[model samples]
Target: MPRRHTPGHLPNDRLTELRSSVRERLGAPRPQSVHEHTPDSTHEQTTYSAQKQTHDSVRGPRTAVVIGRLLGLTFVLCFATGIWSHYLQDPLPWMRFPTRPAVLYQVTQGVHVAAGLASVPLLLAKLWTVYPRLFTWPPITSAIHALERGLTGVLVASSLLELTIGVMNIYHWYAWPFSFRTVHYALAWVIVGSLLAHIAFQLPTIRQHWRSRPSPRRGDAAVDVSEVDTGPAPIDRVQTDHVPADSVPADHVRTAGSDRRAFLASVAAASVAVVGFTAGQSTRFLSAFNLFGPRRYGDGPQGLPVNRTAAAADVLTTAADPAWTLEVRGNGIVHGFSRSELEAMDQSTEDIPIACVEGWSTSARWTGVRVRDVLTRSGIDPHSRLRVTSLQTRGGYAVSEMGPEFAADELTLIALGLNGEPLDLDHGYPARIIAPGRPGVLQTKWISTIEVIG
Candidate 1:
């Protein structure tokens, strides 16, 4: 029977009776002291068993589980690779990214972008499969149920916004008033937390439908049952549920599994299509497959891609001024050199991949004076951390900090040439900072100053 409610606080006899009833039902002691203040907290559990027995739901638990697993994998991959990219662009104290593995950021960021792209189809499919459950009767069955829905809401909304931010960012679109990096980073955590909570609430459902059962015999109402025994409340457990004959979705009402199979296949194909073509920007071998990639891997001036041009940066005239000189400053010393003088300095050429946060990359032979040589000339320790400031007079990417590992690495340079010729203005002409394993944005094109720091 449903637990009865009365006016004011629960009476002592009713409270004691409720505790005993629960203890007997579970055959275990449920500590009631934690909710003693509320007095009627446990009363909500009344009729839960009876209600669950008659609960009607939309079928597709198996579909939901399968889509969920794939969606969750993309989320995890995107989050992990996102943190790695974030650390590279904005490392916390005591964090030092390696200078070797010159293409590490390229690979991780590529995976991150690809995972985000793949998630779109998977997310839509998962939402479609489970959307009907949002209308469950008696929505707030218990405190935990309320929590479960709240978490799911947050996960869905935040995930949508996060994906939007990522797609927009790749194209350098920032229509939002908020800082994209700050908001995107914060939302990542929120989405991940909500996802974990939602997963916890749905663990039982997931376990129940983790694998599909045999197709029901023709003419016996179609069902998407699991091989495992789910408890009393499953929508697919057809014989026990008292669902109305007309309430089931049409797809679930079909006798054969053709509809469900076709649906899953379509969603999978969409995911593959979205990821396969776009990933060519990052996957060199798949370059021929690139259809909508924002930038081709090897299709810009001087055989390299460019995110920001001199005109966009408002540095066209300034970058071209021959009077311009690269200054190295530290302590009480300042050493400056014109482009030709710096070019005349002992230069080393090496193949380095200029990788972008947008997931595009191309390797090029860069020739320039090593950073440590410039630092030493400024009377600073060759191993000291330094700041590379660009000729651009605006924006965050114009100035970037170099860690000691990169400053000391022989490959870190004030590049003066690309592909055996002077750099194009779009490719950071005169000179630009280029280091191994760094994001392209942080390469600080159109060099102006390098300052040593602690």
Candidate 2:
């Protein structure tokens, strides 16, 4: 109202003077038109708001470091236990698994499953703590940077998939078309490899930000004044300010350190709960606490949990048939044993636990003829490697191998009874292999044939 301002009609000297004055007042290096300033100003406001929001809510590097360390430790334990289980199931020629510790498999597999389950919460917490990094402004700055992000993505995906399928496998669920064992085994290596690469890439950043420190706040003297004058600053130096007492309730305030500690504590509590809920399946003493566990101790036939029942294996009719005979073949010699004939032979009793790969185990008094005795009776060398075949025509574990050491173990038996009763059809019926320190799957059920390969 005081004076009318002309646009293009202004003198060049006047326009230059005006631009200089405006630049001086705003601390900008250059003058912009109203149209140019409007969009730029709006964009800067939006960016500042977003940065402020991120600074206030996103977890600091300290939180990521702590959670990441915990996650790494848990993953290491899970990986070691998982490798042991895999080797026990499919051992290499040079590897010899111990047979003395009767409960070794039970304990190891139990720890494996429990550790894997507990890692679920830990992994989620770690991912959440570092989630803001996914939105890093310059997503790709160079080839190495692009490779680092790609590896991180692979690590996340593979870890999640491996854990998902492992839990599903414990529940006896197969939803994927690919072989669960093969894929799960292979993805474990990928997860570990990617994790190593990710750690290498982030090691410097992790070391720099591992310790918590007092951060500057908005309007604080510690903040760079030049940044404030510039309007929108990079998020790296952004700080959250405390609300004024008159503007917001004091009780609503939360310190960053306290929030980080609370989040970590919650994750720890979740892991504990998960382990407590699932570890009971293997530790019989703690079974009552495992309400969420897949299998209960004594929930199946003859006080033993059955992972695959006769009906599920489609062997009910075949296994229950009166003419069913166990065929034992060795070096050009074949011998068949009828149920009565096998029972009429010397029956010995030994307490053996059926430790399954699914992480459930139950100890029972098993009565049967010694495997060595059967091999001797059949005129076969008990020292030779043997293959035990199940009556079930279908399933991945229909046939399992017995190393010479396992076959020669005196405790190994073609069990005919459990807990002083005739074996339930679901409990491998007439005869099933029960070897000390062997996986339940390797203790082949519904024995239809035993072929000595060497």
Candidate 3:
């Protein structure tokens, strides 16, 4: 007959026999109950099986819930920062930068981009934790699920498109129509709407889990090994070998169809978000590529100088030709100059921002003859108005008139090389206007004329 432990009453021989039997049944690294025994008595032992199951069962979702909350908080922060950067009416309280419109615009734009990038890793880990739930297709689903799916679809499409185009603009890739600007602007509101809806849907679950908190700390509790074994059972069948709590499968029970569907949805949403987030900034890298490749400025008519219309195709010429002429007409003054004569004047270089109406900006080194030099050479007063023309006859040539002081600002120049080398055809190769603090359209390309007036 098998003997059972009865605490203080068991004899030494019985205790020894029980210990041996328990070890054999439950395997080594044996469960020990730290019951105090008199110096004359055998040591007491308790099983660990019950304690182990209780630990695993209670801690599994608690860990997941904690991580989910952290990730959700991070997501909220990312979105909040982006919106604040874009639309907040006032500067952050402690920020030192003065609230000039252009300065604020650039600073907020940079902050928005930085925050967006940071979201990638955070959202990825969150998705990993939540993805398992997507596989479960819930029974008795309501209209809410349908609504969630629709919102998710919109978020995915809008996010991908916005990220792609926004990145392109930042890098100055103009292959696509600027119409993307209008579309992206409208879709931003839609994205905000969906994000709000998502948060609302999750609020109940978030609050419920927060209210019912569980301990995250792991304790060194002894397991109840006896629960695993019936009398005379082999150790392997009775109990599992010790494994790390973290490695244990989260869901021992089979997942329902609804649960599986939920897991899949989470995965799909996360995958799209991370992919779009990462690929969206390729254009930034591309923009920086041109910075070191060539120098773009040179001696020429500067400011809004007009020139004869060349064949639009020839506007995309490579290697400067001696035939280049600048047309300047303003204040009843019309004059033309050979490329060599303009080059003979005092030349200088400037690093200036080329801002486009489409909302991109680039800094390039512009080496060129000053607008003052061209005006002085033509016997035209710097105070005279100017109109610049382009070789492309279809679009009316860009026009801007400025007084002597603004025209002669050191930041303004007519550029020949883009970064460090001569301009590439795609970027107005042979002499283009590059004025600082002005829209890109105001900078005429394919220089054929600069018409100036007194």
Alpha-carbon error at 99 in model 3, in Å?
14
RMSD for all candidates, in order, please: 11.5, 10.3, 16.2
- Whole-structure CA lDDT of model 2: 0.74
Off by over 4 Å in 3: 1-149, 164-186, 200-321, 328-338, 344-346, 353-364, 370-389, 392-409, 416-429, 436-445, 448-454
Report the C-alpha lDDT of model 1 over 1-454, residue by residue, as the tens digit.
2323222222222223333444546666443322232333333212222121112121265677878899999999999998988888887867888988877778888888889988989888888776645655445666777888888898999899888888888887888889888888899999999998988877766875576633324232222222223333332232322234343333333522465667788988999998888888876798899997877878889999888888888899999997999888889688998988887789999899888888788888999999888777767898887888888875569889888889989999889999899889999998998899888888999989888877
Q: What ranking of all candidate models by TM-score puts the best one first?
A: 1, 2, 3
Badly placed stretches (over 4 Å) of model 1 are: 1-59, 214-256
Tell me the tens digit of each residue's lDDT in model 2 across 1-454. 1012212222221222333344545665442221223323332232322222224333555667777887888788778977888887788876767787778878877877888888899888878766655765445656887899999999999999988998899988889899987898899899999999998987754664466533333344223323332422332322334433333222222443466678888989999999898777887788889888998876777788887888888998999999999999997988999999999999999988899888788888999999999999999988888888999887768999888888888889999999989999989997999998878889899999999986
Backbone clash numbers for all candidates listed:
0, 0, 70
Better of 2 and 3 by TM-score: 2
Off by over 4 Å in 2: 1-58, 208-254
Error (Å) of candidate 3 at residue 9 is 34
lDDT of each: 0.73, 0.74, 0.45
Give the number of the best model, judged by TM-score: 1
Better of 1 and 3 by TM-score: 1
Give every collision pair in model 2: none
